[model samples]
Target chain A: MRHHKALFKFAIKAGEIMLRNGAETYRVEDTIERILRTQDLEIVESFVTPTGIFATMDEEDGETVTVVKRVRKRTIHLHKVALINHLSRQFVEGSLTLEEASQTLQEIESRKPYPPAIMIMSIGLAASFFTVVFGGSLRDFCSSLLIGIFLALLQQGFYNSRVSRFLVDLLGGSLIAVFALLFVNTGLGAQLDKIIIGSIMPLVPGVAITNAVRDTIEGDLVSGISRGVEAFFIAVSIAAGVGIVLKIWFAVNGGYIV
Target chain B: MILPMALQIISAFFATIFFSVMFNISRKELLYCGLSGGLGWSIYLISNQLGGSIVVSTFLGALAVSFLSRYLAILRKQPVTIFLISGTIPLVPGAGMYQTMYALITQDIEQAATYGSQTLQMAGVIAIAMIIISSLPKSAPEQRKAH
Candidate 1:
């Protein structure tokens, strides 16, 4: 009975880690089930959504346990997802003892993301390169690079603020437009539109949109709808951010510089 | 034209690499992510230059990205989402979304509607492309009940 309880806790912990790190709903459910089934449990089931996970298992002696883990935050860390996937596979293959598996999962859980300095630089470079991809000139690229750096800094500054993600994106979008306008107006950049577009690329909800579609296709309709709504709102916040700034600029300048 | 196309592809490769860093993908997989992004954007450019509409070109580009991601997932033993999300970044409708919102803010309702629907269509086609690729049957060895 104690062994079964430990097994259930371990499996649910693995699922929670996956869920918190942005694994798909079906993937989390599948991982939990695979891990639990390794012990010959009579009943094992897991239900996951974008926001929470519910799992229950039963033993042959009429001993049943259910655990519900509520996941409030999600960030894309595919490295963690891949690690947990590998761990679960090893556990299912019986190559790993339960203690070793749980210990490794603990280590994986505490793994930090890439260093902030590197992340900020990469965010800036991503925006600038995207500017070039969209046909921006060298001057525009330079301007976008600077704007991207500032946007990254802004996001980092707000990281611990507990503000809504949408608000951060909204501010990031406005900052991009403001910088683009200032650069173009001051003759530092040639294409205002290109610069704004490039810098905003970092804020786009590519992961959410893709995961939403994938979850829906995998028949996790609840996760799908919620993620789709997330993507839509993120897009809107970004647009509104840029739109408000552009509208104000146009009104002040009495012309369409966009 | 060829030079521009090559430039776009190269930029897309680097862009995707840095984007993957933001998503915290492991270091070893960064190069493959870049390769997939370059492949997707190259396909998009080629199809567009071949007279395909923007929507159709985007669909083809996403299709290529999805296929490459699945293949890389098997070869590298990583989750397919790691590649799929980063690779599709270059084809996402960020520019279109901006243009639509810009038109709307300027009170150009006609232009806004046009760009808005185009953006929606591009997003929709990308989703459909992913669904088609994911729904395809896998071979025996690589088969997993859940993807």
Candidate 2:
């Protein structure tokens, strides 16, 4: 049992590396992710139990490590923290060891979060709410909400990413817009923002975008920049939805010029 | 007037419970988490009602939760973020996201675009509120504790 927990025991060690490597968000950024990605390890009931990172994961050594996380405080060499960046700056060159640079990455990788079902549902609802709010009108709101949540759910249903996620989003937005309109013909009132807004609320990038901007303002440059990029992409996605729909509407109805 | 606000508090309460459960909160501590969130949300609503900025309201709400969690972390002997994230849900700018999105649905392109930027601002404000409220432990740049 002791041997099983030994491999992942470097968690605190990993944190030390964050400061040593001068990485942003301290590799603690991806805790849930790294634990889930281990091919050799099997975790049993690792919830945020009051016990501190509780779970029974079988280590490669055929032993169970009873993992319990606690308030980990340790002093680190602040000078070493600036050294990696200094070295890179002095070199002014691209050639660097993947090991050195990647050590920081591995630490970040370790902080990835677990995508729980309820959280996913919450995310979907939030996204739906955002779209519904923009769509306006009860019919538009409901359709957008339904579509956005459905699309987000599709991402879950297929474990989608990259290109697949993009395709699903486009399809999801289009489908929701079209269907919500169709449903409106069923005699729904004009004041349906409530339903629509609630549904699409999950789609808004508020949290991620807010976190990004806040990080930048808070002085976590790397995390702030990365989060900013993520926020930009989400914004772009929303823009694309607007552009595509507007183009279609223009072609058919001669609506206001974009 | 008060009912939806109470409903929102309830919604936030459930959200906190879900987060705590995921984190493996002790069963005995469950009510504390929910109540902390609900109470934090009520404070947020009240502050916003008093002509305080949403960001300011969120900050106050987060502060309420953070102080409580810090107390509970001592009383309950657990990490503060665990309690903080749960209790701070109601103040997370969930509603602003919809406001921006609703603005975008308009045929008025100019207005839609304006709302888009507004949406981003709200998001940034919310993040600031969250970050400001959660008192992070200081460490050297090299330290990489789990966030």
Candidate 3:
């Protein structure tokens, strides 16, 4: 009985980590089932969504344990997900004990994010390179690099300010458009369109779109539609942000054509 | 012409590395992620050069990236999402989305609808590519089935 209890706890812990780290709904359920089957539990069922996980384990002794975990925050940290995935596989293979598996899960949970300097530098480089791939010239690349760096710093500031996510996205979009327009109007870069597209690449909802499709295909209609809505709004907000800024630019310059 | 193509692949490489860093992928696997992205982008560029439609190019590009991610996942023993997410980043329709929005702002309703539909179709094709690649059973199913 005690072993089953510990195993149940460990299974939920693993699922929690996977879910918080942005594993898809189906993957989370599969991982939990695998971990629970490590023991002789007769019944192990798990259901996971983007925001919650509910699982139950029943043994032949007529004992049942259930756990409900509400996941409030979701981020893209594949390192944590990978580590937990490795740990769960090890446990299921019977090489690791219950206590050890739980301990490892704790360690994975507290893993640190990449250094801020590294993140800022990478974002800047990504934006700049995306510009080049999209047909921007050398001058345009340099200009977008500056814009990317600025946007990265701006995003870092917004991370801790407790601002709403929608507002941040809207402002970020407008900022990209305004900066690109300013640079082009000042003759700093020859292409405003390329600059804006490159700078906004990081803000696009690539993961959300992918996850939505995967979830829907896996028969999780709720998570699929919710993630799809989330991606749609992100696209809309970015567009609205850029459109508002462009409208203002046109009005201010008395409709000076592009 | 060749120089620009090389530069495009290099840029895609760097872009993938940067994105992988943001996701905090472990240090050892960083280079592979970048390679996957570069390979996918090269496929995209080459197919575009061969006169494929945007939908076809994106579909092929994402297919390559997804297959590569699966291979890398087995080799590295990590989750496929690590490589798949960053590798497929280059194929997302950010440019089309922006063009649609810009058209709307300029009061070009017809142009806005055209670009909007194009963007939607690109997204649909990319999703299909991801779905087809991810559904393939890995080789370890025998072991999984034993349990």
Best by DockQ: 1
- Residue lDDT tens for model 1, B1-147: 999889989999999999999999999999999999999999999999999999999999999999999999988989899999999999999999999999899899999999999999999999999999988889654685244
Write down the lDDT of every candidate, Cα atoms only: 0.92, 0.47, 0.85
lDDT per residue for candidate 2 within A1-258, as digits (tens), equals 443343344433343343232233422333322533343455533333111233345566666555545522211222232233333222223343324534653544344233556545545444333333232443543454455556556656655344443454445444444444445445542433344344333333333453443445446566667656754565455445534654575567764421
What local lDDT does model 3 show for residue B70?
81
Q: Please, what is the TM-score per model?
A: 0.98, 0.53, 0.95
Of the pair 1 and 2, which is ahead by TM-score? 1
RMSD, each candidate, Å? Answer: 1.2, 13.7, 2.0
Native interface contact recovery, all models: 0.94, 0.06, 0.83
lDDT of 3 by residue, A189-246 (tens): 8888888898888888877887887788788888899888999999888888888998
Which residue runs does candidate 1 get wrong by more than 4 Å?
Answer: B144-147
How displaced is residue B139 in candidate 1, in Å? 1.8
For all candidates, the clash counts are 0, 49, 0
- Ranking of models by DockQ: 1, 3, 2
Provide the TM-score, chain A, model 1. 0.97
- Backbone clash total for model 1 is 0
Residue A137 lDDT (model 1): 86
Which wins on TM-score, candidate 2 or candidate 3?
3
Residue A91, model 2: lDDT of 23
